[model samples]
Every structure is written in C-alpha cells, then in structure tokens.
Target: MPQSPTAHDPNDIQEFNLDAVAGILQDEKLDYRIDEHDGEKVIRTGFINAAISFILLDGSLTMEAMWRGAPSTDAAAQVLAATNEWNLTQFAPTIRFFELNEGTLAINALRHVVVSAGMSHNQVGSYVMSSIESAVQCFEWLEQQFPDLVTWKDEHHDH
Candidate 1:
C-alpha cells in the first residue's frame, strides 16, 4: 500500500507585512515603532537603547546598527584595521567604517535576508530574531576590540 500525500500547512504561508512583523515583535514584548522612509515602512527598535533600524523591502529585510563617535585620530587607524580583519574573517553582519561627521568615524554592522516570496510566521520570526542577534553580536565583538565603543555617546554627549 502507498501513503497519501499531505497538504501544505497554512501557517507556513505567511505574508510579509509590517503588521506581521510588529506582531512578532509584540509577542516577544520588544518595543518597536514604525517609521516611514521614502514611502517605505521601517521598524525602529533596540537592545539596551543601542538602536537598530529595520528596513523591510519588497522581498527582503535589513538590520543596521551604528556606533556613533567611534574610533578617531589614532584609534581610527586601529578600528580600520580591525574592521578589515572582521570583514575578512566573519561571515555575518557586514561591517563598515564611515565618516558621518567632519572627522569622527562611525561603525555600522548590517545584515540582510530576502523573503519577498512569502514565509511562515515562524520563519519570519527566525529571520527577524537572527538579524537582531547577529547585529548585536557584531557590535559586541567590536566593543571587545575598543572597549569604549559602547560609551561613544555617553562620553561625547554632543552627538
């Protein structure tokens, strides 16, 4: 005797919408606010007020965390070196050094995933959680390099 085919689960066929994204975040009790940028809705939230921006595109989502007032002067060189090393070694959360101000440099850790076709609620949750976790991990690793990267704002106060 042969076995019969089973139907696909509806729970797995989830639509990628801001509301669904918020629902997932709400379920985790994480505070998130929706903001519109260029007519696209984005999710803004954080870990310990570190600040992370979530960009939801047609079939993709991205997470960006910036370390303001990061390495400067002598430290800038070291951070550039470390950033090159991290980018060359790590696989997740691509890191980059940017000059946001006149001289100070900021570090950005970014992660992205494509989900335009659609996904299950659980899949969406995993994608969102993974993005946040990886971003935080990247920030933590950089902090280990400079130790004071976490206090960039507290010490500067002018940013």
Candidate 2:
C-alpha cells in the first residue's frame, strides 16, 4: 500500500536571509556584530584567541579564522605539508597557508555552510559553532605540530 502525501505548508519553505542568520546566532547566545565590507555582510566574532569572520552570502556562509602572526618564508614548506596533511584528514573546515606581504606565511581556517538546501536554525547554529571549534582545533594542532613555525598567543585572556 502507498502512503499518503503530507501537507506542504508555506512555512515549511525557508528564505535564507542575513538578518535571520544573525538572529539565529543571537538566539544561540553567540556574541557577534554585523559588519559590511564593500556591501557584503560579514559577521565578526572571536573564539579561542583568534578572530572569526563569517561572510553571509546568497546561498552560503563562510567562517574564516586567521592566525595572530605570520611565519617566515623558511617555514613555508612545513606549513604546506601541514595543510596537505590536515586537508586529507579533516572534512568540515579546511586549513591552508597564505603568503602575506613580505612573503610571510599565514595559516587560516575556513568553514563553509551551504544554506540553499533549507537548513534549520539549530543547524545553522551548529554550523557556526562547528566552525569556531574547528578554528580552535586547527590552531592547537598547528601549535603542537609546528611549534617552531607558529608562536601561540597567550591563552590567559578571557574567551
């Protein structure tokens, strides 16, 4: 026997909006402020001694965490090796090394959420928190694996 189709209420369809995302973050008790760079919405938050920037786009949201200081060019090969190793193991947020001004190496953690598929508010919050946690994990991993290349900031500061 075939099952009956469920009713499709209009409310079942969700419209992904920046304001909604912000509200969800607020509801989840995350302290964040919205900033716009060149008219693109960016949610700025801090976690685990690193600054997090969440970019609100049409169909997706991206969270990026940058390290405090850059490493010297001599450690670029090590950084690349770490990036490759982490990328092969991790699936959610990714780690990458960037060449900053003066040829210094900067490690960054990136997490992206595709919202066009209709994610719930809880799901969004989980994504944001997951990204934040990923940043912390990546930072700690680097500190443990490449202590010579990365100098960790003082964790004495409040979270």
Candidate 3:
C-alpha cells in the first residue's frame, strides 16, 4: 500500500554531509565556507547558498504539485522548470560571492532545507535528477564563462 504523505514530517528530514558536498564545490572552484549551528554543520559557498535559497523558494511555489497528483510527465516538467529557476538563482549568488572573494570559501552553515531539497528530488523519481542536470548545466555555463574560476583534480581520498 502507498503510504500517505501526511505520514511524513518534512521537518524530520535527514542531514547531508557538508564535507563531501564542499569538496565538490571546491573542485568546481566555488568559494565555499562552513559554519556550525546547534550541533549541525552547514556547507555553503556564497553562490551555492544563494542558489539554494532561490531553488527552495521556487520549489515552495510548486508545493501544490504534491497535491495535484498529476501525470508523471507533467510533474516531471514542473519539477524541471522550478529546478532550473532555482539553479539560476543559486548561480548568481555564487558568482557574486566568487567575485567578492576571488574563489575563497564563502558557504554558510548547512541547513535542513538543503538536505530536504535534495531528498525531495532523489525520492521523487526523475524530478531530482532533472533538477541536478539543470544545476550541472548552469555550473558548466559558469565554468565556460569564467574558466579561471573553476578547477578540478583527481579524487584523492585521505583515509
């Protein structure tokens, strides 16, 4: 049987690792910073934080999507559109932060919302993947526009 949405508490969402994500942001040459609050750590770069805020706001706008119970295609499209908008907004803040700091760590503390947003896409089938693709495209565009601002290296896991 399908579990009802009411059974889930959005606030009881899981936490994501800032370190892993931070490494990715760093590889992309996005200035990221970390901070702690109430035993939780946040990993954000100025650009990432801004982008996340925008995406969260936009995704909230589509909250009705959950209630609509529409076709998967329609749902996917809506998710993609909102995700793209969020990615764009996120990009601006990150870029501005990069310009201000010149590729220094600028991310704020990690928040439950960021984890929730990622979970929402991950559990919702292609919605999250589509959103991720959108974000990747934006990142690529940013890289192309500012080649010096982005960099990457082989994964060197220090045990």
* Maximum-TM-score candidate: 1
All candidates: CA RMSD (Å): 6.9, 6.5, 15.6
**Model 3 off-target regions past 4 Å?**
1-123, 154-159
Residue by residue across 1-159, what tens digits does model 1's lDDT show?
A: 998997657367766676767877899999999999998888888865257888887678777877543677557789889889988998878888877677778888887777687787877788778877777777778778887656644444346
Please identify model 1 stretches exceeding 4 Å from their true place: 1-11, 152-159
lDDT score, residue 45, model 2?
77
Model 3 clash tally, residue pairs: 10
Model 2 reaches what TM-score against the true structure?
Answer: 0.78
Full candidate order by lDDT, most accurate first = 1, 2, 3
lDDT (Cα, tens digit) per residue for candidate 3, span 9-59: 543433433343454555557565665545555443333212331123322
Local distance difference test, candidate 1: 0.76
lDDT of model number 2? 0.76
Query: What TM-score would every model get versus the actual structure?
Result: 0.79, 0.78, 0.28
Candidate 1 displacement at residue 109 in angstroms: 1.3
